[model samples]
Target: MSTLYVEQPWTSMSLLFRPHYRVEVFDEHDTPLMVVRESSGPGLQRPLRHTGFSGWTSFDLDVVAPHGQPIMHIAKQFGRRPHVRVSTPAGQLIGTIKTHGAWKQSLHDPSGQQLCFFTDIGRIDTGARAKRHGKRVRRDRVQINPQVTEPLRSLATACAVAFDVVRGTGTRHTSSGGVDWPV
Candidate 1:
């Protein structure tokens, strides 16, 4: 079976957030065609603190297939819901949006392609707790933005990371290696 390889960039967002992952490239038959590897780095346990709160960094990735196209290209969104479009080297009108929160576009793009993606956490507010017997009261509230980095940049970083992974895995260029995501 033929194989292709992609590189893993040390500074990529996926590496910074996930730091470690298992990648396996499969053939059309769902067989393990080539290049399966795992990685870990120093950023795995690093914590980011802000405004008396601590949260983990994350990166979001989206991959979409254009109408009548065999290959799917990655997409970027501007915000959480009612998403906005971002520019790519190929222009922004691919017209693929995710109905559910979990789905994302994935594609193969050469390096230096300008792209944008979104990232943000939902907000919450808490009031207080009180006791009546002796007149005791406690008041507090905490709102957290779980996102540690910009979504657009994070998505870009994700794309770069995926590209690196695909490149590093070195599973491409082989007739046996293919990209397929079942609908």
Candidate 2:
């Protein structure tokens, strides 16, 4: 790891109720080191995500290199707290992201040691990326403390996208308080 760090940015846009994401992972430099892609048909998960409980539905997301080499894997787990298990390409568990509530998720290493935390501060409309969607994009790349391990920083950031992959795929957010706040 370098002395300087930049938050790796990830953007997700759903198509026809199917979630798709594009992530640019950065470390040790200002530019991206790799790409994380979630590209797959809904298949059986479609109907399952519709009527089934989230704990009963399963899906997998991957972070891969530009050459299509696997880097990290995310498999959301069945837990009352909405935990997501992150692993290496070889299936070795690396870290788990367990949500404490709607506003925070914590990263735990394989040994059940909590490493760091990422928080959701709601949607942000700061740039063309957000405007491209005609809506605010959820801020996924919360700054990980530089003291944390490199692997943990990357894994936690990549896995953060799972936070927004709505299980029911309907309008989860609606206008409230006459201010259009997300619910």
Point to the candidate with the largest lDDT.
2
Best by TM-score: 2
**Model 2 TM-score, 2 decimals:** 0.59
Clashes, model 1: 21
The residue ranges of model 2 lying beyond 4 angstroms of the native Cα positions read 1-16, 19-32, 48-56, 78-80, 119-128, 131-141, 165-183
Candidate 1 has its poorest 10 consecutive residues by lDDT at 49-58
Clashes of each: 21, 0
Per-residue lDDT tens digits of candidate 1, residues 17-97? Answer: 433332322323434322313222314332331111111222122332223222223332222332223234345443322
* lDDT score at residue 6, model 1, on the 0-100 scale: 19
lDDT to native, each model: 0.27, 0.48
At residue 40, give the lDDT of candidate 2: 60
- Tens digit of per-residue lDDT, candidate 2, span 33-119: 566555464455555443324334554678776578887887764334556778888989887776665555667788878876653
